[model samples]
Target: MEIAGTLRTAREMGLVACTSCTRVWPAGTERCGRCGHRLHTRAPLALQRVWAWWLVGVIAYVPANLYPMLSTRTLVASQEATIIGGAVDLARHGNWGIALVILTASVAIPLGKFLAIAMLALGVRHGSALTGSRRQQLYQVVEYIGRWSMIDVFVVAILASLVQLGAVASVSPGPASLFFALSVIFTMLSAQSFDSRLIWDAEREGRRA
Candidate 1:
């Protein structure tokens, strides 16, 4: 069935969906017969969970910026650099490509995911000019790009592991590395916890009004 040319959602058609299996059952069914996954018309506490994880991610991000992400010890001296500081240092040395990659993966992607997830949450409740399909696409993009945020952490870890020269030189991950990794993880969780069905719900309600 279609309403105002919008296709009907499963919930409107009296069906429950298994998120894990992508199978639909009659509305009152308890679980998916094929996948044994519990069925719900929508995820419980979806928005609340997103906000909770988002808050923790934000908290972790504060320390991530304030602390050093890399620590180096050489026979002559010691040095440390935060994420942005390291990227800038790389750019100064004409390693512009590496600096750009670090900045984009560490800074731009994470911040963009945060903003996108927040907007998706708010849009579901209050509505927006974006169509339902556009909102869904934004959610998919958030989920897809989130894992790349770990590139900086992986680089730091690999460098730390490879550069152990006893007395000559050593590289170690700094406090900020842990915090940055945590922030990326929590934000990924936030993105996963969103209920995309709500996007269609909001659209349906808008058309009816």
Candidate 2:
């Protein structure tokens, strides 16, 4: 029961296959009925689809950094803070842990995911023989870390809900939240769009007599 290409496009369309018995199953199934093996499925997207969304995320990233991500109001005064400002606030107040979390989740992780995705997309497009394996690893890492970018959004939501003190003090999500979310989503899509089969295809082509 080895995983095979039959499950790739099929799984992308909501089908899956058991890795132990090579049995096909619907996407919702947790295990193969015949062999009770874990299933594997390809994520939707071929290559172009992933690249398109990746590009969108990259484009959105600029505005995500430029615009404010959190706003505060207290005593009839309003203040908006960009990503850097938020980090600075945390650092200045000695909340180093929170500051690091915000920095990594909001700034470093998303950018790293985007750059890695873009590199994978470009590598796949060019069918570069020199670095295919490296690109694949990058793709996997981008996919795995993509969801963590939502931490900032979660924090914003929590603060917004808990800090509602009428005119005394309040916290609100800023425009950058939407952009940052879009950035994360697009990079995830980009990672999904990449087809690992492309590497295999090139390898096969190389081996053909």
Candidate 3:
């Protein structure tokens, strides 16, 4: 039995939830009987894994922006376009909607994910102005949107596949395409490495203090 308006977490009630199967068990349980996965009140080395993957993503993103994402060769001339430059060219060619989508998915969303994950990681470590529920929601959003970070890569791939006209005009993915893809992949790994339960633990500790 529990009281109304005074919610209690499973950890507070001497229970641990399996990270894999989401089954609840007593706190001292070493492994989940249902799934046979090792159980813990919180993920081990969660912050370290998050930061490591985040740093790699940031490193990859630099060259991804500086180098050319797409190389176009035509009988007349050759042109190379970076992520932003490609979007700008598209906009200049009156494809405003597509340009906007590319910018949002490639630039804005990835940057937001980096910042959000860093904030959540730091918040659990030191302290945060946001409430636990808010932090939880932020984490959920970061995880949910991570998969879409590859939109830029997919766009480049599609263009490369479609724009082959026997040397008259051919578009191909450049070096930045690989870096951009790695950035997206590492960013997703960073988001996945985060243990959202830490947010609740931090809140509990705050309440006790």
Candidate 4:
């Protein structure tokens, strides 16, 4: 836990940061003068919040995949399409690019996010074989790509708005849209709740006792 050389971290330099405003303050300063927020070097319950939101995301993701994602109404009849069904429909219509995008954003992305978040949480708990830089890049990737998962929702909204024709046909979002949106939101929150600083701490201090 001792730095043998001259290198030092903020903790070693005897500094603390305001969790709310992100303003650096002397370690002993009572509160952030600008924001009036209590200052701490780190979030008090980072991992707990991460896990809680992760579970919510996982639960929401189940229904999101299971239920219909889009509903269509025509003079003939009504049709409901789940995510996979929608993608397959797109592919059948020769819109393979759109179908591929939908699958990647809705299905592949959420699964990738779940795995990535799980790895990040577990990496710090169990000593990571990955270099800090590699792990940091992975974290950055996971954080950056999360917003793209809403492509399915956006597409449905756009179609619902643009394809409304009286007695001809109509498209609307279905039950799964809400759940998918919730899942993406919860996963984003879970990713934000993680403390990237802990990634380095494990390298310096070794695994938790």
Clashing pairs in 3: none
Ranking by lDDT: 3, 1, 4, 2
Q: TM-score each candidate.
A: 0.94, 0.73, 0.92, 0.89
- The reply for model 4, stretches above 4 Å from the true place, is 1-5, 19-23, 28-30, 34-38, 206-209
Query: Model 2: how large is the Cα RMSD against the reference?
Result: 6.4
Tens-digit lDDT string for candidate 1 (1-209) = 33634576778788888889888899989989999998889888999999999989989998999999999999999999999999999999999999999999989888898899999999988888799999999999999999999988999999999999998999999999999999999999999999898998988888899
Preferred candidate (TM-score higher): 3 or 4: 3
Off by over 4 Å in 3: 1-6
TM-score of candidate 3 on Cα atoms, chains taken together: 0.92
Per-residue lDDT of model 3, residues 70-187, tens digit only? 9999999999999999999999999999999999998999899999999999998899999999999999999889899888888889999999998799999999999999998999
| Per-residue C-alpha lDDT of model 2 across residues 88-192, encoded as one tens digit per residue | 998999999989988988888987887676666566556564555665676677778899898887888899999999999999999998998888788777777
Please report, in order, the local distance difference test score of every candidate based on alpha carbons: 0.92, 0.77, 0.92, 0.88
lDDT string for model 4 (57-83, tens) is 999999998999899999999999999
Error of 4 at 37 (Å): 5.4
- List pairs with backbone clashes in candidate 1: none
Q: Candidate 4, which ten residues in sequence have the lowest lDDT sum?
A: 3-12
